[model samples]
Target: MTDHAREQATILETHGLTKDFKGFTAIKDINLSVQTGSIHALIGPNGAGKTTFFNLLTKFLKPTSGQIIYDGRDITHARPAGIAQRGLIRSFQISAVFPHLSARENVRIALQRKLKVSYHFWRPLRILDQLNEQAQATLEQVGLGKFGDVKAVELPYGQKRALEIATTIALEPRLMLLDEPTQGMSAEDVSTVTDLIKRVIEGRTIVMVEHNLNVVATLADQITVLNRGEILAEGNYDEVSNNPEVMEAYMGTTDAA
Candidate 1:
């Protein structure tokens, strides 16, 4: 694509983004862009400001300075809830589901947001029941069709993570910010979630922070490497993987994966 076409395809962009604490700068003077239909991976050693960047994008933490443009609008000052309502949704690094709620109920809640009835207690139970079919279908999409009645806390580790993704999918986001979607999973589970991610990614963009280079290789169309809260390199997996600086940042080796 031409430069203009590339610019047109960008769904999210950050300009000079930085965040500072009393004695710490979490991330600094960063400019990044995410294309509308790509899986962009952020990779680096721990404390590379990946989560900080995610917080900034979701408006959970206001940038100390800079602008965040999303889908052609300046949302730098938007609130988290406002941004989510506008279709910029994110999943926490940790699996986030209501432990007490059944898998179907967890997904149902996310679906409720789409119908704008999350807080409609006055509505009859039947009104909420209307979401059950969609919720079950969402569960099936994530390979949890038969586990809909299971409580989230009762699920295995990988299944819990799958439930989280299922709920995220129910929201129908335009961009999905997945923070370590495969963290702490067994090798078998990693493959499962990786495949699940591919299946669910038809109409939306995904920006993921992942440590598994193999997963990044299989899933990422673009890669950005960060070191000491600054961008160290940007390219596809092979490009970043072969950079001496990127290798050095990963403790002087490319095997940091």
Candidate 2:
């Protein structure tokens, strides 16, 4: 790909993005670009406005100023559903699945939603057997093939997270936003989730807010560090990870936290 195509492949871009809640600024003058088919990580301490930034991109919250461009289209004022229709989707840190439903059923519902199938009050979900197959295939892709028959609430926490990823990918988004994707997992679980994330980004762009520095170092092609409501540093892992500003921020937070 030519350099320009490489950049255009950047499925998501933000220029001078700012968000304010009353008089409190949640994100300030942030400029970010995520290359197509690459893993770009957003990292910071708690309450750093990472989630707020996500809300703006996904249209859960409107920006007070600036622009959000996705897939070369201006989406600054697009609604959440409108953005999703344009191939941008986000997964929350909290599981967005039916706790009482089977894993396959959860994914099946997601597929049905993506396809905009009518929700008939009396129609059985089994009527969409083809969708079930597709859901199973997605589960397999996220390493949860065996858990398809299990109830979502019964699976281990990590598997639930994997299921969430499966559901999001089932939407077939060109840009995927993941918020704190590895929260509340053991070391082994974290590694598994990290690998799954890497696998998922093979053909699409991924922008994620990750707390673990190790995960960022392993998967991030580019990194942006947020503090309070503004970007403190932006670069590759080595560049941002070793920057004096990053170290000071971490140190200051550590001392305070």
Candidate 3:
């Protein structure tokens, strides 16, 4: 097999994954697989269980029934930190960074998390200088170099998300789960974040929950549509977009967004 083909082998797999709350099933029997080095998107109308499924993958919610395997290891039972330690990092959420610190400081903490340096709280100040250097490099990679010294809270809306992504990159994740990476952004910021997302997908796998069809069309190597707690369609953008059922699924929904 070619190198790229080998890289496309299954890196994350879910079998019969199910979740329920008070007998109301949120996501049911989801059997999905994400190939290595691919940008895979999970999309659907609101309340189609997209977030619930995303939560299941992150272990934010335990599966009521099923298995989750990552890089040949069963991770269904792994805690969030444990899974993250194994290189399955998640992002595009509001809680990923501290607004009180500067961009460099926020990324420095992520570096500290990866190095497990937090345990040694007494580490010398000199060590943090090294971290700040590395953290600045990460910020540069995500197009936040100019804002490294600015407090995260003071950053513009889109830059905050970019800073959040830079922190996720610090983990060196093998598979990154992005929940609406461009949820609320101006058109120009959308273009900026889009380019950033493309830059970071190199040599890694990404699974994202996104609502922007234009973004999905541009980024997804494969798209999986979920509806009413099940897989509605799966294929390339053109293939799925032309699928009658998939088209019908979006009708009367906010898909025109």
Clashes found in each candidate (C-alpha, N, C closer than 3 A): 0, 0, 0
Superposition error at 181 for model 1 (Å): 0.7
lDDT of 3 by residue, 1-257 (tens): 89656545989989999999999998989999899999999998888999999888889999999999998889998999899989998895564679999999999988987566777988885677778889989999999999988999999889999999999999899999999998888988888989999999998899999999999999999999999899989999998888777777888543532
Residue clash pairs of candidate 2: none
TM-score, predicted candidate 3 vs. hidden true structure: 0.93
List model 2 lDDT by residue over 1-257, tens digit each. 89887767777889999998889988999998888888999998788889999999999898999999888889999889898888898999998889999999888887876555746747765676779889999999999999899999998999999999998988888889999999888999999999999898878888999999899999999999999989999999989877877877888633322
Give the alpha carbon lDDT tens digit for every residue of 1-257 in model 1: 99888778999999999999887999999999999989999999988999999999998898999899999889999999988988899988788999999999999999987677788889876777889999999999999999999999999989999999999988889999999999999999999999999999899999999999999999999999988889999999889988888988887766664
Give the clashing pairs for model 1: none
True lDDT of residue 185, candidate 1: 95
Which residue segments of model 2 deviate by more than 4 Å?
1-7, 253-257
Model 3 poorest ten-residue lDDT run: 248-257
- Superposed by TM-score, candidate 2 places the C-alpha of residue 72 at a distance from the truth, in angstroms, of 0.6
lDDT for residue 15 in candidate 1, whole number 0-100: 97
Q: Superposing all C-alpha atoms, what RMSD in Å does each candidate have to the true structure?
A: 1.8, 2.4, 2.7
Q: Estimate each model's TM-score.
A: 0.95, 0.93, 0.93
- Candidate maximizing TM-score: 1
